[model samples]
Target chain A: MPHLAVNNLRAKYGALEVLKGVSFSIEKGQVVALVGPSGSGKSTVLRTLVGLTPVTGGNVTIHDDKIDYASSGSLRRARDQMAIVFQQYNLFQNMRIIDNVTVAPVKIKKRPKDEARADAERLLAMVGLADKLNAFPDQLSGGQQQRVAIARALALHPEILLLDEVTSALDPELVNEVLDSIRQLAKDGMTMILVSHEMAFVREVADKVVFMDGGSVVEEGLPEVLFDAPKTDRAREFFGKILRH
Target chain B: MERILEQIPRFFTADNMALLLQSAGLTLAMTVAGCVIGFGLAFVLVYLRQTPGRWALPLRVICVAYVEVFRRIPFIVVIYLVLFFIQTVASNASLFTIAVISICIYAIAYTAEIIRGGLESVPLTQMEAARAMNFGRLRTLVTITLPQAWPVILPPAIAFAVSFIKDTALVSQIGVFELTFRGKELNNQGYSGILVFGTIAMCYFLMSFPLSMLGQYLEKRLATPRSEQSARKIRRT
Candidate 1:
C-alpha cells in the first residue's frame, strides 16, 4: 500500500469544480511534483489534502487511515503530519524570523521552547538563513523570505512537505536560492509534493511527475518519461510548450 | 466682554475648577472604558460574523445585524435606549455605568467594521499558513492575525476613542455629570455662557489633545520599519 493515497479527491469553488476525481499516491521519502499550466488545479490538490480547500467529495488515506475532513480532530492530525509552504512565502509579518520558524512548533505543537528554538536555528541554518534569525520578513529579500518559509515548514517535522509554486513569485535571479534550499531538502530524502512551473527543477528533483490540466490528471510517470517523451497529446503539447523556454 | 471678564474670576474658583477637572476625568473614563470594552468585543463579533457554515448563518446574521443596526443608529439614541433599558432591568445602576454602556454599544458597532477591515487587510495567505500548521482559529487570531492587524486597527481605533470623548457629552442628556452636563449646570447657575462653556471647551481640549497626540505617535510607531525598530532597540540598550 502507498504511504499516502489521494483516491479520486474532489473539490469546488462554488459551482466550479476544480478537482474532478484527482487521484495519486506517494510512497515515503519520494518527491512528487504536480506540474501543469496555471489554473489547472495543481495547487488545489495540496490545498485539499491540508484542508485549506474543502473536499467536496472523495477522501485521502494515510497508512490506510482515511482522513475525515469533516472532523476538526482528524484535520488537525492530518495537518500535523504535513506542512505547506505557500507561493507567496506567507511569513507572519508581525514576527521576527526565528519566531516565525518556532511559533507553530512551540505554540501549536506544544513542544518545549528550547528544543523548538534549537530545531528552528538548525532549520534556518540549513536554509542558509542563520544570520537572519532576528530579521523581520520584510527585511529580507524575496528569496531569503522564501527560504525562511521553507525553514518554517521544516521546523514542524512534518512527514510530508507541500511546496505550492514556491519559486513562482520570485525574481529570476532570486529563484535559485529558494530552489537550492528545496534541493537540500530533497537530498535529505524529505517527502514533498511540489507544484512548480520550473520544468528543469521539476525534472531534477521529482521522482514522479503528475501532469494535470482542466482539473484532472492527464498523465504521470517517471520525470524522464513524462518530460522527454510524454504519452498523451495534452502532456506532449504542455511539455513541448513549457520546455521550449 | 466685561461680563465675561467678571465671571472668569468666579469660574476660576477652586470649587468650580475641581468640578470641571472631575467632569473631564469622567469623560476620559467613559471613553476609555466604553471604547476598550467595545473594541475588544468587536473582535468576537467579527469572528462570529465570518463563521463559515450553513448552521452559523443565523449567528452571522445576528452579528451583522448588531453592527449594522447599532452603527446606523445615532449615538444619542443608543444612549437613551441603553439608559432606559438598563433602568428597567436594574434601576440602581449608576448613570456612569449606563453612559459607559451606551458608548460601548456604539463603539462596538463602529470599531467592528474598523477591526474587520484591519483583519481583512492582512492577506488571506497569512491565515492559510497558520491553518496548515494546525493553529486553531483563536490561536491563529491571537498569535498571528491580531498582532499583524494592530498597525491597521490602532490609528483608527484611537481616533474613534479620542473623538468619542467629545461624543460623551451626549450621554449628559441622561444627566451624567460629564463635562458638557457640568458646563450646562454651571451656566444654569448664572455663570456667563461664554465663560462656563469656554472653560468646558478647554477641559475637553485638554482631554482629547493628548489622546490624539498619543494616537499619532502610535500610528508613526506602528508604521516604522522593523529594521529601524531593531536599531532603536539596540541603541536603547
Candidate 2:
C-alpha cells in the first residue's frame, strides 16, 4: 500500500458534484504534482486530504489509517499526520512569526513552550526567516509570509505535505524563492503533493505529474513521459497551451 | 439680577456643594460598575457557546430576554420597577444597590448587542486559521479573535459608556442624587432653574467630550495599515 491513497473520491458543494470518483495513490518519498486548469477540482483534492472539505464519498487512507469524516475525533487524529500549505498563505495575522510556527506544536502536540519555540526558531532559520521571528504576518512580504507559512506546516513534522498552488499568489520575482524551499524539502526526502500552475517548477521538482480535468484524472506518468511526449490528444493540447507561456 | 447673584453663594454652600460632589461620585461609581459588569457579560454573550442544544443556550436566552426587556423600557421605569416593585416583593434590598443593579442590567443588554455586532464583524477566516494552529476554542477567542475585535468594539463601547452616564440622570427619578437630581433640587430652592440646568449640561459636556475624542483617537489608531509592512521590509533589504 502506498503512503497516501484516494480511492474513488467524490466531493460535492451543496448539489454540485465537483470531484467525481477521482482515484490516485502516492508512495512515500514521492513528489507528485497535480496540474490542471481552473475549476479542475485540484485544490479540492488537497482540502479533502486534510478533511477541510467534507468528502461526500471517498476513502482517503493515509499510511493505512482511513480518515473518518463522520467522526471529528477520528478525522482530527488522521489530520495530525499531514500538513497543508494554502495558496493564500493563511498565516495568522495577529501572531508573530515564531508564535505562528510554534502554536500547533505547543497546543496540539502538547510540546513544552520552550521546546516549541526552539523548534520554530530552527524551522524559520531553515526557511531563511531567522530574523523575522517577532514580525507579524502583515509585516512580511508575500514571499516571506509564504516562507513562514511553509515553516508553520513543517513544524508539525507531518508525513505528507500538501501544497495547493503555493506560488500562484506570489509575484514573478518571488516565485523562485518559494520553489527553491520546496525543492530543498523534496531533496530531503519529504513526500509532497503540489497543485500548481508553475509548469517550470513542476517540471524540475515533480517525479510524477498527474493531469486532472473536469473533476477526474486525465493522465498520470513520469514527468519526462508526460511532458516530453503526450499519449493523448487532450494531454497534448493542454500541455501545448501551458508550455508556450 | 443682583438678588440672584446673592443666591449664587447659597447655592455653593458647604452642605449643598458636598451633596453635589457626592452625587457626582455616586454617578461615576454606578456608571463604572455598570460598564464593567455589562461589558463582561456582553463578552460572554457574544462568544459563549449558546446555540440551541448547548448548555449555555438557556442562560444565553435568559440573558437575551433580560437585555431586551430592560432595553425596551425607559431607564427611569426600570429603576422604578427595581426600586418600588422588586423592593416590595424582595424587601430588605438597599435602594442604592437596586439603582446600580438596574443600570448594570440595562447596560448589559445594549453592550451585548454592540459586542455581538463586533464579534460578527470578525472574519471567520481568523478563527479558522487559529483552529488550524490547534489553539483551543477559548484560547482562539481571547488571544486571536478578541484582540482584533477590541479596536473595533472600543469606540462603540466608549460611546455606550457616555450614553450610560447620561442615562444615570434617569435614575434620579427614583431619588438617586445624581447630577440631574442636584440640578432639580437647586431649581426648587430658588437658584434659577435655567442656570442650574445649564451648569448640569456643562458638567455632562465636560465628561462626554473627552471620551468622544478618545474614541476618535482610538479609531484612527486602529485603522488597518495602508502601506504593506512586508513590502516595505523587502524594499529596505
Candidate 3:
C-alpha cells in the first residue's frame, strides 16, 4: 500500500480555483518530484497536503488513515506525519539553530529539553550543521538556512517531507549546497515530494517525475522516460525548452 | 540657596513625608495595575486575528475605540470624570483606589495598542511554520509567537512605563500628594518655589531615566541579524 494518497484533491482561494481535481500517491520511501512552470499549482499540492490550504473537495489518506478535514484530531495527526521545507527558508528568527530543530519535539511532543536538544543536535549534525547548534537563523547563509529547515523537519521524525521549490530563493552559488543536502536525503530513503524548476536536480534525484502545467499533471513517468521520451506535445515542448539550457 | 536648604526640613516634616511616600506608592501601584490590564487586553485584541468568525471585526473595532478614547482624553480629565461619576456608585472607595483605577483604565487602553503593534510586527511566516510542525494554535502562540514577539514588545513597553511615571503628575489634580503634588503644596507655602519644583523634576528624571536606558538596551539586544547563519550551519554540519 502507498504510504500517502491524494485522490481527486480540489482547492480554491475564494473564487480562484488553483488546484482542480488533482490526484497522486506515493509509495513508502519514494522520492516524487513535482516539476512545473511558474503558477502551475505545484506548490499548492504540497500546501494542501499539509492542510495549510483547505481543500475544497478531495480525499487525502496517509498510511491508510483517512484525513478528515472537519475532525481536528485526525487533521492534526495527518499534519504531524508530514513536514514541509518552504521556497524561502522559514527558520524561526528568534530561536537558535538547535532550538529551531528542537522546538516541535520539546514543546509539542513534550519531550524533555535535554532529550529534544540531543535529537536536534543529532539532526543538525546529519544535515552538516553540527557546529551551528547555538547559532540563530539570521546568522547563517541562505543555503545554511534551508539545511536547518530540513533538519528542523527531520527532528519531528516525519514519515514524509515536502520540499516546495526549496532552492528557488537561494543565490546561484548557494543553490548547489541545498540541492546536495536534498539529494543526500533522497539517497537515505526519506520519502519526499519536491516541487522544483531545477530540471537537472529533478532529473538526477527524483525517482518519479511529475510535470504539471496550469494546475494539472501534464506528464509523469520515471525520470528517464519523461525526459528522454515525450508522449505529450506539451511535455515535449517543456522538455525541449528546459534541456536546451 | 541657604534659605531653600533650611526650608527642606520644614517642607518634608513627618506627616508631609508620610503623605509623599503614600502618594509615590499609589503612583507606582496605578502604573503597574494599568499596564497589566492593558497588556492582557491587548493580547486578546491582537490574537483576535487568529479567532474564527465575523465577530472578530467588531471586537477589533471596540478595542480600537477603547484605545482612541483613553489616549485622546487628558489623564486629568479622565481622573476627575471617573472620581466624580464612580464615587457615587462606590461611595466607600478611597481616593487612592479611585486614582489608581482611573490610571489603570487609561493605561490599559494605550498599552493594549502598544502590545497590538508588537503582536502584528511578528511575521505571519513564523505562525505558518509553527502550524506546519503540527503545533496546536495555543501552543504555537506560547512557544513560537510570544517568545519572538516579546523582544519586539519590551522596548515599547518600557517606554510606556516611563510615560506612565510622568503621567502620575496628573493625579495631583485629584489631590494625590505625589512628588509633584508635594512640590505644589511647598510652593503654596512660599519662599522656595524653584527649589521645590526643581527637586520634583529631578525625582521624575530619576524615575524615568533607568527605564529609558533599559528600553534602549533591550532594543539593541533584540535587533535581528542580517545574515542567514542557519543556512551556513546546515552546510557545515
The positional error of residue A164 in candidate 3, measured at the CA in angstroms, is: 1.2
Candidate 1 C-alpha lDDT tens digits along B18-94: 99889888989999999999998988899989888799999999999999899889888998899889989999999
How much lDDT does candidate 1 score? 0.93
lDDT of 1 by residue, A8-92 (tens): 9999999999999999999999999999998999999999999999999989998889999999999999999999999999999
Pick by lDDT: 1 or 3, better one:
1
- In order, the interface RMSDs are 0.8, 2.9, 2.1
lDDT of each: 0.93, 0.83, 0.82
The per-residue C-alpha lDDT of model 1 at residue B56 equals 94
TM-score of chain B of 3: 0.81
TM-scores, all candidates, are 0.96, 0.88, 0.87
C-alpha displacement of A100 in model 3, angstroms? 1.4
Give a tens-digit lDDT track for model 2, residues B1-237: 676677777777788778777777788888888788878877776665334335667877776787678779877777877787777788887666887888777877788888777767778767665655445567877777777777778888988898788888888877777889888998898887766787788777777788789888887767746246455667999
**Candidate 2 vs candidate 3, DockQ winner:** 3
Stretches of model 3 off by over 4 angstroms after superposition:
A112-114, B1-22, B54-61, B188-196, B224-237
Of models 1 and 3, which has the larger DockQ? 1
**What tens-digit string does per-residue lDDT give for candidate 3 at B117-218?**
776788887888888888877777787778777877888888987788988788888787667787788788793887777767877787778879988988
Find the number of clashing residue pairs for candidate 1.
0
lDDT of 2 by residue, A172-218 (tens): 89998899899999999999999998888888889889899889998
Model 3 DockQ vs. reference: 0.56
Clashes of each: 0, 1, 16
